[model samples]
Target: MDHIFFFYFAAVIAGTSVLVVALRNPVYSALALLIMFFHVAGLYVTLHAEFLAAVQIVVYAGAILVLYLFVVMLLSIRSEERYHNQLPVAGLLGVTLCTEVLLLLIQSRTAPAVPRGSAEAAAETGNTEMIGEALYSTYLFPFEVASLILLVAMIGAIILAKKDIIETTE
Candidate 1:
């Protein structure tokens, strides 16, 4: 029963991800990406990590997809530009990478070992609480730095949009 839902969610995510790449229109691609994000969140839910599921939807599907839509709209890309194919080189590289991955998987004999951790400790702590403690206590600087990088990216997007407006007005 649970396996069914997980496979369904995984399928949807994979399909939407392909659609995201295959679609020519930037807006359509972004919408497909949004679908993929939600399906990923669903997968996280199946993994019994509700906080991760919510964060996946909120941070990625909600905020990031909206930002992608804004950039797509602001750019005002043309039909010809959207339809332009860089597929030959991209396809070759993609195929090469896929083959390499397949080879690596086939050649690997040993099953990956799981790290030894206190099961009782983990059972007492919810995924969200554990993640929060680790992020805040152990990885505080890197987390804050990521936030700063996102802020810079937002500012950069605003500046670029403004520059486009100014240029058009001139």
Candidate 2:
């Protein structure tokens, strides 16, 4: 059943997201983040979002997760110094925001709207080829913008990895 699949995906996504937050080791956290992306891509597929799922896996899980792993590996220093994040105000603000969102969610549980699109759409135009056609034809500008963002991120990552040197003759 589609209902069962949705619940399965939602569970995986939520579980992986929580693991990403609770995992202390940077590498484990990155792995959890990748898992979260994968589960989210699965959810997109259930919703007839073929293009979104591809982008989620390719751009996020493939590119961004690799970048995060490289950063984590680079910062694998053996210093056991404990660091404290002194952000009491920011923490309180975040808690407050979460509580407000919880309240909003509870209030909306009484009357849920019918979901758009049918299961038929999920069967039709569900492959990478059709998704790419839609992206390049209908959403060309947004796709170009996303590519630009990825280009900038790649450049920034390279710059971050570069070592600066100074030479002097006395």
Model 1 RMSD in Å is 3.6
For model 1, the superposed segments whose C-alpha errors exceed 4 Å read 74-76, 80-85, 108-118, 164-170
Please write out the lDDT profile of model 2 over residues 1-170, one tens digit for every residue. Answer: 99999999899888988787666677887898898899899999887677888889999999889978887788884432443475577679979999999999998898678787676764665577677788899999999999999899888866665666222221
Give one digit per residue, the lDDT tens place, for model 1 in 7-114: 899899889988887887878998999989888888888777789999999999888889888877888975445443776888899999999998888877576766
Among all windows of ten consecutive residues in candidate 1, which has the lowest summed lDDT?
Answer: 78-87
Per-model C-alpha RMSD:
3.6, 4.0
Residue 6 miss distance in model 2 (angstroms): 2.8
**Who wins the TM-score comparison?**
1
TM-score of each: 0.78, 0.69
lDDT of each: 0.86, 0.81
Global CA lDDT of candidate 2, please? 0.81
User: After superposing candidate 2, which stretches have Cα over 4 Å from the reference?
Assistant: 78-83, 87-91, 110-134, 164-170
